[model samples]
Target: MCDGYVQCNIVALPEAYAADFARFCALNPKPCPIIGQSNPGETNVPLLGDFDIRTDCPKYQLFVDGSPTAELQDIRDYWQEDWVFFGLGCSFSFEDALLQAGIPLRHIEQDRNVAMYNTNIACQSAGPFSGNMVVSMRPLSVAHTIRSIQICSRFPAVHGAPIHFGNPKDIGIDDINKPDYGDKVEIREGEIPVFWACGVTPQQALRAAKIPCAITHAPGHMLVTDLRNAELATL
Candidate 1:
């Protein structure tokens, strides 16, 4: 609900996997841009804000051996001493730019979480982190879609621009109305579905890697930081 400020996706990994996970983000920056990260056993990332990693986010998803096991409100008791946290730039940051540009977003207008889908696009593997890319879709008019590309391109740290538009089949998305994550919003008659690389991609990579334990922010639930969106914009 905090607008204008930067929003991030959380990925907490054990010390053993931290280096590889960081490499994974560097290799697949479109979906896993790292804005802030903490050292192993550290709860605070001074670059983001004054907050505790264990309790900052509204919700957390617990994964055991790549399978989601539970949803948690707080992770204090579950925190591991050797785990490192990475804050990946989220699509929510660029949504503000679109709204400000006078481009209406379907999911925001419908008051539903943006539609997200798993795509056939393969991510570059780093260590064991390898999987197809996940994307968030926004249905917009052709004119607005072009403008969105220009506006979002300035914020590369927040997924940059639409990776694909028009045909869902081209992206391995068979059904436009049935998304793999988040609620489906109706694509109006004149508008086409535009997809952006999503932060949730890490979760898919985590599943492929089959890490013993991984913690991530639940879909649609993000960590709000004090950094402003404008601070991340390119000239």
Candidate 2:
């Protein structure tokens, strides 16, 4: 029940393509770590334990015709027998680890959602799943920026390392102050923007695939899980 525990980003899709998506995550483990999974018609994620896949998550996205249809408080009504669940580690899971290491997160300090941008960098495609990578940004001093990358590198299961730093234009971002998703935070006199592989990467992929139907956890309202932050660390 620790707030610092890992919070996952879930994708419960029709079993016909679940395996393909899983393969996509496997191929790109940095952005999508498989922490828990479920077979067809099963609702529980044993790795997360005693979990109810339909409602344990804070919020959900319903996609119809490859576009977001509506937000749901809970998705029990849409649960299908042909569905399977895939749990990917969230960026929030590593924020606690970062804070513990004395790396202050600008968004958390400002009480805002992390800045996310849809990058021009395309992801490795799988059957019906291909899209640009989405990234989260935080502004910090140069020294702290390196430290954050070093600490995050230990948790490859949760977006192990930052994809890029410094120039936003290199990633196709036109403005450092304007983001495609989430809120922007002040850059301060000495801080530079740092980016990370975000959990929202899957959402970008889903949109590209244009799946007839897909379900995903909404931004910020991640699926809280039983895994502790320390448990996800690697040397």
Candidate 3:
């Protein structure tokens, strides 16, 4: 597991809303492609095999009143009997695809989190879950940009294609250097910032609903699933 490995983005919510959220992901495959789910009262994700929703994630974010209150290493103590787990595709799975194909990412080299932003774009709501899309950014040359589009288009399980690129302000981001989440990287000369539908988009939806309580993997600390990235392709 060098540079190219499938990384999973995960979330766990009340079983009460799991079904609707699952259905919503089905309805909106591009933004939310759910790879696995766990039943109520279950701490393990069977689909992911040997995965513990509470401890598998390297970092956890506890949300109260729709806002993050603390970042923890594990959430076993807060686990609820009604909780359900969800595993979604992350852009990290495709980072290997990009690098193997010869694209260079500044943040990865710098060992930083991918820059994320809240866009003016609105997602189709499910029940009370709705909000503007959140996206992760990577800067690349024009040639690599087109090449990445072709490469990432094959992995629809993750955020499939670029929603927007170029000037960040157009996407409601005032400063590309100051990301709403994660650390920003240098945008090389002649390179434009590319945006992808982040798995974090679902968290935005969760916050908009103002759920009583919820938990999610820290932005970059995702679940390492049993399913391989190659197995996620439709073709």
Candidate 4:
């Protein structure tokens, strides 16, 4: 019910595949920082709050053998006894911090989701999990860029800091307006595009793994937890 708190990206898979997924997150902490995880068959994550994993999130993406099969509002029907849910810190937490520090976010200003792209940067493979890094972009002035880095560095759990800034092509992003995921926002003449490791890394891994069945939060529609955004700050 709270919108001000940090919202997390969710990933649920069978116990048979959970270990590999955990390793994948460990190998790619920037995009897959694990904030909370549930025991096999349990939907509750004691660390985040008292909430049902199947029903708490607003949206879910169902993948069958690695391909996205459907988008559902609730995943009650897809629940399995061996399923383990992982809660990954999302960029939304740091976005809040940035806004509070007067660092304007073009995506929010334009009423659109932050632009995200699949970068050529390869992630360390863990078992069957392997994929290119994915990043979210925000256009900011040179001054705000430095301030954002300082502010976001305090929240490591939610993707600590900007990974790349300035020329999008440096990260293999061919076009500023064309994003692999999420909506595109404006980039003013003086503003440089800043990129952050995104929570969508697991989703990309899921596609690469092609497991029989996997579930993840739909891009942008995150799990709103009881944990406050301020609580995520390590500094």
Candidate 5:
């Protein structure tokens, strides 16, 4: 649903670990900004939309003891009474804004997902959650890059602004053409890779935490919420 509304990354876990996960997002707001959450055993996030968390998103990744075990279309079978769901603001919101402003997104133009990489930058630890930050990249000309920064800065909930631009090596990314997640889009002669804090940061933390069971949105397949992208902007 690449429409005018914003989409979100989903993280669902047992209520026992919910506080730790909440703290993780609080400590690292850049990458894990929480927009809404559901109470234990509840599948609805009224603040986002009238929908069931179990089947709203296009796809989900199931993790067992920190390892991704399966990818599924619906997670109804795995739902538990103690499950708490977190709806996180995703880069898709700001990407929509960038596209509206006429800033070219190579990934979209190339019919591919935005390139993402695990960064050497460490996130503030909170209980069982701690890992290197992950970022999504888009290639843009210098002029468009500046405009994108200005445009994105208004949406802090959805990872506002580029955290890094130009050198991929500075952020521990060895190859511009190779990404740790998502497909690689071409960076043209006058274009540079602009990186934004990505929602995948929590998945990295999940890997480190190794919780017994957890569910997260599959990369790039976000929950389409009724909330408009404009509603998330501060200015």
Candidate 6:
């Protein structure tokens, strides 16, 4: 809900696995860009904002042994002494750049969550964390797609630019309408679906790691940071 600000994907896990997870993010920067993080047991990520990690995000996902077990508004009860939270750069941060560039996004215009899908593309493996990449799609005309690539390339910290455009099957997405996550939107007559490496890729990695317990921001529910989206632009 905080427009023009940076949004992050939350991934909190035990301190014991923090190094491996950090390495995983480093190896797969596009889908898991590390924006900010908190020390063990600390609920505050000063680098991101003056907010409490436990209660700041609108919704959180609880994962047990790589499987989602519950959804929560607040994670107070599940908080752990040795927990470490990593704030990953989110695609939402770059949408403002796209919008400002005059590139129309179908999902945004329809007031729906962007469609995300699992792809055949594999990420660099780190420890127990390894999985195929996930991507978010936006349908745009050829002109808009090219313009978006130019605009979004300036914001590399938030997934950079389009990874693939045109055929969904080129990236292993069997069906465009049946997304693995989020609502479906119309592709229109003259537009092609453009895909970007999504922050949700970490969740797929989390599931592969199969740590005993983990916490992540639910899809579309991100942590709003005090940082401005403009501040992240390289140009």
Per-residue alpha-carbon lDDT of model 6 for 140-173, expressed as tens digits?
Answer: 9999999999998998889998899999999999
lDDT of 3 at 8: 72
lDDT for each candidate structure = 0.92, 0.86, 0.81, 0.90, 0.92, 0.93
For model 3, how many clashes? 0
Highest lDDT model number:
6
TM-score of each: 0.97, 0.96, 0.90, 0.97, 0.97, 0.97
Candidate 1: residue pairs that collide: none
What's the residue-level lDDT of 124 in candidate 5?
A: 96
Quality of model 3 by C-alpha lDDT: 0.81
- Which tens-of-lDDT digit does each residue in 1-235 have in candidate 4? 3656979899999999999999999988999999998889999987898899999889999999999989999999999999999999998889889888887787788788788999999999988899999999998899999999899899989988899998888988898889998897888889889999988888999999999999998876789988999999898
Off by over 4 Å in 2: none
Kindly give the stretch of ten consecutive residues in candidate 6 with the minimal lDDT sum.
101-110
Judged by whole-model lDDT over C-alpha atoms, candidate 5 comes out at 0.92
Candidate 1 lDDT, 101-134, residue by residue in tens: 8999988988989899999999999998999999
lDDT of 3 by residue, 1-235 (tens): 3234456777788888888778767776767888777789788766666767788788988888789889989988888898987888888777777877889988989998889888887777788788788889999888888999988888888878777889888978888888888997899789999998888888887787777888988876777766677766665
Give the better candidate number (2 or 6) by TM-score: 6
Summarize candidate 2's per-residue lDDT along 125-192 as a digit string, tens digits: 88888888889998888999889889999998899778899899899888878888999778888888
Error of 2 at 139 (Å): 0.9
Question: When superposed on Cα atoms, how far off is each prediction in RMSD?
Answer: 1.0, 1.3, 2.0, 1.1, 1.1, 1.1
Query: Tens-digit lDDT track for model 5 on 28-96?
Result: 999999999899999998999999999988999999999999998999999999999999999888988
Give the lDDT ranking, best first. 6, 1, 5, 4, 2, 3
The residue pairs in collision within model 4 are: none
